[model samples]
Target: MAGKSSAGRTRAARRARWWQLTQRWRMVGVFEINTGHEFYSLTSMMKEGMQACIQATSNTESQNSLTDEHFKTKGTQLLEGFEMHTFAAPVFATLRHSLDISEQEFMNSLCPRANYLQFISNSKSKADFFLTYDKRFFLKTQSKREVRFLLSNLRRYMDHLEKYPHSLLVRFLGVYKIVIPNQLKKYFIVMQSVFYPDERINNRYDIKGCEVGRWTDPETGGKQVVKVLKDNNFKEQSIVLGPEKSWFERQVKADTAFLQDLNVLDYSLLLAQQPLHQDELKGKHSFADLVIRTTKSLDIEDYPTHLEPSSVPLLRSRSEEVPDGAVCVPGQHQAAAEGDGEEILAQEINSPAKDTRCPVELQGFHKHHQRLLPNLKNAVHVIDGLEWRYFVGIVDIFTVYSIKKKLENLWKNLRYPGRVFSTVRPTKYSQRFCRWIHEHTQ
Candidate 1:
């Protein structure tokens, strides 16, 4: 019994040490980011690609419209045994700038002082996700076809964002490609995290306004805390919106229309729920102020960035099999580690002047809410009666209604007649999605 107890204590100590070294960092199996072993070895290709892309963005001049040259501006770099390719470097750079993410801030967020990139497990999509230490942005692995579609519709998407600056659509910050020694290729698209405000989200749902297969299994029960509930799992609640309601309703309509025009489908409104504190409900603290305070509250000195293990460890081999699960599912095991290094909020200083060219509805909406940060005001909806603060954004906008989707939709409809599957035609899908959102939010 004494020996068994000793073994248990030893295991506990090792676990504590791991958490200290990683500051509660979570990874897939044994995958981890160690500077000594990984900085110049496993992840070197990605680091080199990012550095090259940042430099290309720094050198390129901003353009209102993309030209053939912009798409052709391929910056290639040859690292140890890997080849890194950046697609439309200047064009993505302009997108980053337009979002007010400066080059320095961008570089810092991706390649932080800790040199750690946490792997997100079991993404429902075909792609894998890797989050930065600060969690400001995450890299989603994409298919070559998806990349092509995005580039083709790049101009229209940019125009939409420019016109409807407050659009709740997910922001794609950058795109990249890496070729391994065997000539196998990997594509990555970096996107701003919708829930990056560092708020404590109690619940999350991917609402598509569809009913079939949208409900969570009753067996999960309390375990749902780690899972993202779907449309059917969502409870119907009356949500009260401030003046921002007009802006949100209008933007959703416009954004969905934009997606329909691009033939994009299978997107959903990603919603997160945060239970409000008594002080927050009483207006002692505005949600905006809480977000800002939470962001700046983290003192960098508290978490020293230079800690390293006594010796370099072997790198974990990359698994070719794509994990099957939801995006960024904070599994029960990772609960403790998920909160350690939450966010290092990127403050946007010297923001561009508001465009007076906005339509009267947008102008009126901006007048009242402009005082709050754009992201804060746009993303948050506090319902005092419900005692919940809701964070929402439109996500998974890449799936296009191509020939493959058409066939899939047809097959599904035949299999389950009168059932709403997510793979419908773009126009009808967007209309249903918008209408569902309108009805649910009301």
Candidate 2:
């Protein structure tokens, strides 16, 4: 009973007082797959601790009263207090229950280490953005208006997903709220990161196809980190989708229908290019492989370390509490393993670099030092004279054509001399965006 339920917030919600928290945009965390390093929030650490304390108190207080069926039906309670609401999604809940993992394991994946959410110096969105430690997830600040909009259309969105399971829209996994005693409430929407773990993106662009605020000149103010260049910048690179161009266009059309139907706009075709130097992709003995070598040296965290001290006690023997018909299990999940465990571990860690090389076969490389791109045999595709796989996702879909955006556009129009701003009407924006993508998608 610590945190107010989403139901409670929905009951008391109104527009006027809650729209004040859209000031600074601070981003949190990132996860690197190759290195297995991830950014996690300390507040997440705090939440886990607080959740453990609460669960312990609840268990002790209820004792024999809370039966297995009762606990199973009610679900495990996490942190709660104040007027805000936060809880894991059904997918997470089912996964935890099915796997028989401690609640802390799920929490760790959501918010791992004590990594700080850094401010994205180049961001144009009003909401703060944070990347997870492994960069597989993004945590962003949300405004009251947007949250309400999403809540209103939540069912429609769910139905759409149920209809088209593989729709390219950014996977919206979870939504949450944080309310402090006296401040405006903090809202967060957690999303699945579009890119994959093993891929190294060399050239990336956030293509809105809008002329206004889309361009990030090399001469721009802040130092360039991982640059989210504009449409113009993207065009300059002339990186075409190549043989997969047709497939991409089909995907765009499918995704466009979904967004346009929902009146969603200001979204971008986020494209990341991982130019796998033919040599690097098949680089068996090259120095570029050192990054992977060093990554392997580091001690990777298999589970959230923060939960170890106190949570160890809370995780009572699983077998002792099993119901009459239940099965006893061991290892990571409540499942039995087959085959050599060592082989499975090695396959996961030492997955062959190309078709040829394995970690076991890798020596200090005093013998062979050749560009191995030509020698390795595997699936191949050439894009603009270079072979690469483009990881594409439609992001920033939460921006609705609200009254605030309308006013902002009006002000921008008056503020600027002639042409209406790039952040124009949502319909026009989406049209222009999709058109530009179609035109340049060679």
Candidate 3:
């Protein structure tokens, strides 16, 4: 009798402990779902949307196949209160237009009774938040003014929800308002919305220029004049002549290895060969003409009068074509002669009787060459696609302190061949190519 009583007591104690453990787990699960970042309300809306989808397909085998346990899941419970009339028709119509799919097909693929129910259920059970990856749905609504109006209405409805924040709804509607039919436009909108909405708005709505006045260089102590060119002009120039002076400077600074191997003289010659005359027509013609003519003219003071020279000839010569004993390349000397005559002519044409101070000032040929060549080549290498990709990838991966150890290990396995030249590698005669890359990248 005593042994039986003891066994019975032990069994009772075990059962009680198991019951308490189960209740504790239930409470912990409830806390995870309902406290902190709970999406209870969003889950409710998702469920409602899902149930409507299910009811619409009630006659289909897909709907009928769902087990009783599926209905008992949190997703189904949320959908129990859903009304198909609220979202189904609008959502279907929008998707039909955006995806170029029939309403029936979209419903079959996207809001399938099983997927709808499963997603909602999973959101309620496991996910901290619910997000739809269906871009077609957003795009469809964005393409139509009527859909936008409906979204505005939806925003108002959400605003009326007791727990919904006004700021959140405002941001959501702001995004909905900016969608367009073009995929590129839509992509731009989405990117801006996710990463830079405030910056976009500030650019769009704030037309006022800098209140603090123009930027002054700290080292130079001179007011910096920022020339804001139109996008079309900037892109055109970039494609035709390459990136602007500032872009080149930044690239040169970023790649130290490229700078070290660069042949300053060859690099300067290439820059001088660029059609500086064509760029002169765009308001800032004189600056480019000055830089080009000054580099070639060995006589620095001659650049100011080179822009309007008589009989400006288009000279084409290779590196070997340079005349013997020419301090600068023969092509550069010819360009300078033509540019000087052109500048004089331009000055006479633009102002007949008044003498204006030309901005062109010449430094010594060798001195200017030394100063500019390294920077120019470094800039060119930095912009080279292969070089830029390699360096940028390195910078991005190695910056994180926690990942540095892992990256160091991986770096051992990644072979960087010294012979692998960048996309802009100089022809076989070029000795400065590697040096240029090394200087800029380092």
- Say which candidate scores most in lDDT: 1
Candidate 2 C-alpha error for residue 85, in Å: 2.1
Judge candidate 3 against the unseen true structure and give its global Cα lDDT, from 0 to 1: 0.25
- At residue 131, what lDDT does model 3 achieve? 24
Task: List all candidate RMSDs to the true structure.
Answer: 16.7, 21.1, 28.7
Write the candidate numbers in order of decreasing TM-score: 1, 2, 3
TM-score of each: 0.68, 0.54, 0.18
lDDT of 2 by residue, 1-442 (tens): 5366775676566432344332111121122322232323324533454345334432232222223342222123344444435433443233223223344543565545445343344666777666555445566778877767765665566555444333456666555666555744677776666654423556567887766666776443544345567777776454454323433443455565567667677788777676666665466234445444323322124223654432321132212332332211111211111222311221222222122221212111101110111121111111221355556678877776778888887898788867535556655665555556556655
Per-residue CA lDDT of model 3 for 1-442, tens digit only, reads: 9999999999999999999986553232122223233444433344345345445544433321223332222211122333222222332233223222444544443343221111111111121222222211211123343334333343233323212110111122112121112421211001001111011111111001111211222231232211222212212122121112212222222221222123111121011112222323342324454355324333334323444432121121111221222222111211111211211121211221112111112112211221121112111111122111110101100011224434543453354333222222222212232223222221
Answer with 1 or 2, whichever has the higher lDDT. 1
lDDT of the candidates, in the order given: 0.60, 0.46, 0.25
Lowest lDDT sum, 10 consecutive residues, model 1, at 343-352
Stretches of candidate 2 off by over 4 Å are 1-42, 45-84, 91-106, 114-119, 196-199, 219-224, 277-386, 403-421
Predicted candidate 1 versus true structure: per-residue lDDT over 64-173, tens digit per residue = 67777886677777766777787777777787766667888888877655554544322367566666667678787888888888887877877777665546788887
